[model samples]
Target: MSDPKLLLIDAHALIHRSYHAIERDLTSPSGEPTKAVYGFASTLLKVIKEQQPQYVIATFDAGKSFRAEQFAAYKANRPATPDDLKSQFARCQEFCRVLDIPVFALAGYEADDLIGTLSKQAEEKNLDTLILTGDRDTLQLVDAKTQVLMIMGSTGELKLYDDAAVRERFGFAPEQLIDFKALRGDASDNIPGIAGVGDKTATKLLQEFGSVEKIYHNLASVEGKVGEKIQAARAQVELNKQLVTIDRAAPVTLDVNAARFGEYERAPAVELLRELGFQSLLARLPGDGDGDAADLAAHAPQDIESKYAAVLSETDLAALVKRIKKNKAFV
Candidate 1:
């Protein structure tokens, strides 16, 4: 059997990109701005149709990330979220609720951190994991069992990166992405790197010396003013490393079973889409758009009563063993 695929979405990244991509505002029936909502919904449907993942979770950014606490100016350059797009965040979240996907966010971490934590957990379970995000910083999370689907363009063009793809794109392995970003600095996040280093210079430095530490260690050997620039910004380079690294252990606790994707009622979902004026998405609902009660009933969340439980006593254990034996033929 094929390995189960878990699709982890960076909700904030998608919503922000979707909000900015369109020139004109999109509004719902009541005139609430909904371009972000519409864009997120469309992306979700497209991913579902194409990837057909068996497990899914959408993660949103928690308030201010710990980075902001560490460096007050972190991401300070960005303007406030546009009110129109900000208003649509809750609607997009509700759409996730209607679709029965677990929504996750922690108090002091960004969506990328949650994804990193879950990706680690999924790695332990040996599941195939895919991260969908517009943030390039998430490239650090790619590994043997994990892949990042970087969403590009208004149409959500996906650039899939495994370790090999990351290497091909950046001239280094996925593991070096954090270090590369640290040296280059992320202007979008207001990070400061060496004074004059750009992507080409950063790439060349990494390719030659492997990492920031090594470059500094052999500062004398590095030729040119770029080497002097690296020495001058040593403190910023170290700080940037801390800022760029994704914390895989982000104090997130997930009910792994609850996160497992399951069938959910199609009627309510379609109803929500219709209410949102998403006629284009109504056709993609699980069943025909006839609003059949039977279809809804058939797809109701699985009851916990039928699930196996821990045997706390010998008698319970004996009963459970017998039940397992009884079902052995089917297995």
Candidate 2:
């Protein structure tokens, strides 16, 4: 059997993607914004059905991260979260809670850092880690035991990036991605790397020198304008490295067993979905309402690979309902 996979979700990235992917604004019965909530729920359910992971956890950015505190310009280029999307953040978190998934949100750490910490822990425990995120910074965490399911486009297509994929895309191992980003800088996060360096220059430099420190040691060998840029921006390059490197030892304690994807109670998840006006999703939950027959028919696993349906009729729904009878078990 394959090793138990621990799925770590970047809450804000997925929420932002969901909010924008959904063209029309959706609202709850009370008229509160529900677009992000619907998108997150739908995506989570879809992944759950497909991956069938034995564990799931979500990391959210609680407030200004340590990077922002250290560097005033960190993420400065990014706009403020939209009021509508902000309104749905709470509901999105509540949905995770209702699903019995463990959530980690450190006050001064970004979700990437928390995920880094957890992924490192998963490695120690010999568990496989899969990160679902749209952020490229996460690519730094991709290793043999840890892989990232990165969103490739606006259509929600995902590319599972492993060691080879990371090397192929970034032209270096996962360990050197921080150095590559440090050299090129990330305009999206407002991180200013070495002045004149860009992706091609960064990749070529890392390929030759292996790291920022090594590249500096061999600066004399590099000939051209790129050499001058690196010489002049030494301090900025170091600072950018500090800003881009993910802290794998963030001060957050996580119990691995607590994050195991156990059986979830259907009532609370169903109730939250109803509150968020996610009528279509209700069918995905076991014993959601009086629509057992309809739910059984609606979620009948047309893809066949889902294997969520063992039988064709109400028997399948009942069997699933029976399986999740335990408080912390999964159906």
lDDT of each: 0.84, 0.84
- Worst lDDT run of 10 residues, candidate 1, spans 287-296
Q: Each model's TM-score?
A: 0.84, 0.85
Best by lDDT: 2
Model 2, range 1-331, lDDT digits (tens) per residue? 2577889999999999988888998999989999888988888877777777888999999889888878998888888788888878888889988888888898999999999999898888888888999889999998889999887667888788999988887779998999988888888999877766778888988889999999999999999998998999988889999999999999987687778775777767766776777878886653234664455466567855545445678988787777788555873
Q: Model 1: what TM-score?
A: 0.84
Q: What is the Cα-based lDDT of residue 266 in candidate 2?
A: 73
Model 1 regions more than 4 Å off: 287-331
What shift in Å separates residue 109 of candidate 2 from its native position after superposition?
A: 0.4
For candidate 1, write residues 65-176 as lDDT tens digits. 9999888999999998876677788898899888788999889999999999998988888788999889988888888889988888876788888888889988987878
